[model samples]
Target: MRTSPPEPLAAALVEGRTSSLKEPLLRDGRLLWLEQRPQEQGRTTLMLRPAGGDTAVELTPSPHNLRSRVHEYGGGVYAVGGNDLVFVDDSDRCLWHLNLPGAPRRLTTPGPRAFADGLIDGPRRRWLGVMEAEGRDQLVAVPLAGGEPQRLHQPADFCGYAALSPDGRQLAWVEWQQPFMPWQRSQLWLAAVKQDGALEGARPVAGARPVAVAGSGPNATDAETDTYTDTSAISVFQPLWISPTELVVASDASGWWNLQRLDTASGAWQPLLPLEAEFAMPQWVYGMRTTAWDGQQLIAAAAREGAWQLGRVHLTPDRVGTPAAWEPLEQPFDDLAGLSAEAGTLVALASNPTSLEGLLELDLTTGSWRHSPAAPCPLQPEAISQPEPLWFAGHGGVRTHAWFYPPAGGAHAEAPLLVKGHSGPTAMARRGLSLGIQFWTSRGWSVVDVNYGGSTGFGRAYRERLDGQWGVVDVADCAAAAQALVAAGKASAARIAIEGGSAGGFTALAALCFTDVFRAGASRYGVTDPSALASESHRFEARYLDGLIGPWPEARATYEARSPLAHADQIRCPVVFFQGLDDQVVPPEQTERMAAALEANGIPVEVHRFAGEGHGFRSGSVRIQVLEATEAFFRRHFQR
Candidate 1:
């Protein structure tokens, strides 16, 4: 049988039309995952595939979003135990449970409290998760039989990644105080679990302590202290127990987030694999898994030099010498997530330039793999733009990385270059096939994704390059990358444009205002005023600017000097702004004010606002509308 040829890449590059699958959970011979279906009224549903079954079962019914809004970037939304699945409903922020093939039943009361980062405690018949309520965050246990939640440990500004020991005798979690985000400085805590499932005798690992904590009470005066004064601060993420007295975690104490093992009996941490690559990621959302450990081996994903790779490590009871090299897993993915290990089988979400995101299962012994909801290449091989990894000297000759995707066809001798700044000033741009980037490249444009200063995966020094230099360092690196591309004849020097959302949007605006590298700019709910963001943002990132730009009032001059709104007159090129009316992170007013400023400065400006949208657009039609508007706007100015 012969298959029909694929349609044009541009025609298939509809924004938000493709489903994004995440968080693969394997247990009891079943595969469970989360599927965010934008076409289904932007509903994010849970799915399950029984053992040896080829069809996927839609476990989440209508109007029920298996999502949690905790920390505003929800993750750890669902957990599985035997034939039951526990999840957080986005509508009311309550825990819900569903026996296999049955309708979901509400398990917790609906209220102001938000629950996320859930872990299934089968031994205790409870759900261990991070709960935010009444102005404090705590790790708590909610009984599966439906009862009042019991607070497990001391409260912190934020808590996440609650993992229970296999024997249910202990609990491990990650906590961090305010003024510092999880990526900045966080501590790992181990505590004894009582018969009643309450946590006690809590102690910090590696001699680390909370930076600041005013006791637990309504009368506490300084509950909002947002500074990490500890000199030897370390950030830990994703603690998983490999044995009753042993656990594996990723820590950045050595300047990179490498794997480390903590022995409860000895209270000493053993470095497993020490390298510059990151085995963990920033806990921006709950339920993010980077490393998976079976009883004897581990499957982990690490990022190095803007690319993601998979590898495995064998474990022993005693401390062993580090292997000369990691046992590399040959996979076709450049991006991986939701890693899980069951009976030596590794299941994860994998994707790359030629494939859509899907669930991947690999049998370590036989070197066999299977991809579900199989996504064959939607375009001809020649139509897909392969990314070329490039490094250029940033400001002060500091090294920086980016992935350049030239126009797929050789039809266009000179093409407009799109300088894309990814969000998470602390986040790295993983090399993968992004439909948004491909949309531009397939339409005769060259796209370069800049992993500017402060992006993760690199060593601590590289990740902290933007500390107190957010706008300055990021803007300079992005501009430098674009200039380098033009110099190398990979892009048209006269037709370069910059675009980004959130922090990335702020970089786009700064690149256009502070440098002459980009001819036009598009910002999606980008930060316009650092001072305003410091005040109006949510609690999760309210004090984040203290490190990015510095504490307010002391660095007020620098904030004013670097803000895009303050230097609007310097923007001599056309600019477009896309904003979500309901965004709490970078408020819509920031985009509105910047658009007004651009118009006042005699620069052509376009502003499009979508209602019922938040920090990011979940509606497929809205995303497509924005993409169309942005394309038309960029071409009009570039062709002029």
Candidate 2:
């Protein structure tokens, strides 16, 4: 009997005609969002859907990229108030304002300054946000009428997440200093806004110091001590004002990011729905909202055991001491973000394992919801591969999580495996239906998206596992995940490969050098040398290595020992590298040096360099090329 191979998923299904949506905002019964169109040469434009209209209209014309480069990984690019909209123009990196039926006018004189996390001060006729200039960040106010931006405050080395209280009398923002990422150690500060828009009486409201308890630390082993200290500082997330004298925020003081309310006048914190779930995510970019007030109650999205769910909390000033009444909403989405609520309407970007990312709208009054996908799924439901949650023993026997996708419509007894390490090193491997993952599965390749020990969506202790052990912990976990699949007799032990981009790329390269689990590997703009990254990185990530590996020059030997480029001879597998010439985060030199070293060692190597591409490939054609090249390279190597 002759058996035929399964049909492969099209490359265009993963790259072409698909647009990404971000920073979804609901204002004045209108839905506004930024759409990154890959087919249009990766230009991001503003989209507006009228109050009751089904079609969305483009507001920003050609070449007007509504992007911010403040931290290189920019977000919170646009803000709206009534009819006025403010955004950062990527071409000039300057702030621009656009009112309906009028052309956008430049607000600030472009120089080395870049702005993000913007908020409109309609009453004061000014725009407020974080401004980065000369390697320092400060809260600045740019007048809508045109002039120099006023420096409102420089509380620390970095500052963002600016929020104004109701009645416009008080200002609230989050701040953190060097050597600490915002998710690791950040403070919530509040100040009075003067009649002239100057800040006064600025004082820390929360996240000032570490949370300690009597007789026990979070990981206490000593019994003799009367008091124990926890060294990790409390990290604060998005602050939203619920009343004139009260505001709500998420703080990781209880080992999880739980919602809490603060009374400004009395300096007291009240617990709101203190569950063992995270109400916030890592602050990689600006303007990340996990909780929103819907005029009657607090609507929040929380992560529990690697999946997300939406819930509501009922609390008021009179019920301060009582437990909050929590109500969970039954929805199909497992991943959610960019939540915005107004007048009993809730909108967010959401997706599940069987669907693409879409704009989800929920009517609180009627308890009904509707989903509008960013793009239609090109494949049928039966062709999709569902993710099965897998828990494997990771580095040092610690339990780790991952999503395993079996080969779809294939009769192979032992399928080849592709292990993926997600970027951010702090990021999680979500259970969304990624067409990229499906492209391999539909072609009879099993896949595992490993959420390493240091990944988020878990408690703080789990996330800190990679602290000072970036290359070692991540590499071990990825290898363990692949080995687990092989042990289960579902995948071939000799035909497994690993691939990652950015930090994930570093993991894949390091695994090839230090472990023999993978037969081949691929890296996209990966960090081959941590020492080089410490010296050549941008301002936002200058001190990021302090926690990841250690201080740069002080731990110089550790950096060199763990770098993949420093030990390229140890890698015995054929490798392929993809790089962007203009990547400021992980420069092209990192890829060039590693590829050169592998070639010198007589190992099979392929390098693809895109001239205008930066850290991430945005053009549809380039994405298609990368996908096809990677598949061809893997096939060629696996056969040998």
Candidate 3:
């Protein structure tokens, strides 16, 4: 009787076949899956069987240390290297360890090119949070039960994700400095471990600063005790440590990020749960970063009521005032793709846009849930094709958010429309389900996934409505949501074509240099120079293009007048790119100088690189050779 979910895939931008989930790891009882198949060349590989077995086991066939980054997820054992980090008994002198399979051993040494995320398993010790490439700073330790890694207490700007204490004693982290961003304000700290193990001095339980209660005499004290401290405290982010001294972290104080709890030796605090939504963030620094405990309860991974799941908090030790309820136990994710909670099961590796992320478990003492293995696809679920949810109205009157898939087994009498451009121009193009937008809506062709305007679960004022309005209203709200879904009949205005990658390939080269609602486009590893991402990025955003465009030699002529490679003679249509020739973040010469200026302006361009992929494109054979060469270049430009 509830059969009204199919009408939503209407003007789906460009979903020829998409479905990308994530890493989620468990091991032994089995629940590992990392399928990409980006057509086959951008392949990812890693599948184990068990939970509900159908007998899958590719354990990693030809993984050049898995690209596109997913550093760590399970500290029980999981550490991958980069630029030489071999391990099975010190073969490459081990720089990072724990990928089991043969017990490699060795965790850190050989500093210099850093960047890792996903590690924190305290109690026999193991923390790893490094980030220095001038990594804006956050280098904690216990990198491997050894020594030399402890450096917390650093909030004048960015002090990595620490989290410890299931009995490791105490150490919840999150600090921020220099021009904000950790959601604008952070300073969570909390350390205390002495029984001979050190680290007993940290500060800020969640930003505070007013200490000066003196009253001595022999030391001439109590002049207000010459004390005042308040560093403007503000805290926010996945902090964990659920009990030992109590801690749960993730804050917005209460505007969203949720979770909260503090007590480190009693500056005392609480809220262990309490949500309107938003439970955690910061993916890939190593991967897991916080959430996944079992002592009493702590599950986290959120985005509430608008999808993305896995939330559950129960901590019941000497019960205090409100520990926040929050229930929802996973389900509603067109793409959660990875997660691995503990204390008796809770896996999840979802995906739906078109399918390819399977693996689910749940069970934490009968909350009951199963779903395991049912996500591998090259096509077939009736050839897939199903992603719908359009919303619209954007342009500040608000109401935006997109996801549409149409193409599966329908022949379309004339099919053609593939507008995408999504790479977080602020990130958002979620409704989950997508196997490359069901390989372009199964086969008929049509897919649109724009959550344009600085996306992030519709809040903080429609996510700063694209802040200074990057590339003019995110390329006119992705060409007015593809001309309001082909004037509402759902696509086919002479068939559209637009694709994206990094920053949705900079809004598909700024919607082919300022809109006409896409005629032809594609950009993987995008960004056609925002003053060269503010003279080369990495400092965790080095002023993130001064808030997306401005403050760079004074907006140097509005970043070369909103650069689309500075208007390659006002593009005519026909472009193709897929780079990663080791992308230093949108650098393959920014797509070979925009494919030699759109192949000398006659338009019809092409690029393709992949050597070791960098900005994005981590083999599965170059994501199925960039999804079969962008579906044979949109079927040779829609059959001409």
Best candidate (score: lDDT)? 2
Model 3, 68-101: lDDT tens per residue?
2212111112333221112211122123444435
TM-score of each: 0.94, 0.95, 0.33
Worst 10 residues of 3 by lDDT: 82-91
Q: What is the lDDT of residue 533 in candidate 3?
A: 73
* Least well predicted 10-residue stretch by lDDT in candidate 2: 212-221
Residue 342 lDDT (model 3): 55
The C-alpha lDDT values of all candidates are 0.81, 0.87, 0.59
At residue 559, give the lDDT of candidate 2.
96
Question: In candidate 1, how many Å is residue 516 off?
Answer: 0.9
Instruction: For residues 1-640, write the lDDT of model 2, one tens digit per residue.
Output: 2134357888987997789989898888999998998898788999999998998889898879988888898889998888788899999999999886478999988899899998999999889998998877778888988788887776546788988987899999997777889989988878898888887766567766432211211222224232223334889899999888888999999989988888887777788877888899999998799998876668999888888999888785653686576788878898999899998999999999888999999997787999988899977887888888889999999999999998875424378899999999899899877999999998889899999988988888888999999999999999999888888876898899999999999999999999999999999999999999999899889999999999989999999999999999999999999999989999999999999999999999999999889999888788888898899999999983
For model 2, what is the alpha-carbon lDDT of residue 296? 66
Q: Candidate 3, 530: how far from true, in Å?
A: 5.5
Clashing pairs in 2: none
| lDDT (tens digit, per residue) of candidate 1 on 1-640 | 2123223354235554677787888887788888887777568898888888877888987889877888788778898887767899988889998878788989899888898888788878887787888877877778888876676654557778878888888888887877888887888878788786665566566425536543322223454332233536778889998888888898888899888888887776678878888898878887788899766788889888777889987665555544324788987787888899898789988878766677888998888997764345456666677788889999778989988887756423367899999998787787666777778877778888988999888878888898889999999999999888888877888899999999999999988889998899999889998889987788899889999998987889989989999999999999999999999888888888889988987999999999999998887778888888898899898873
Q: After superposition, how far is residue 202 of candidate 3 from its true place, in Å?
A: 2.9
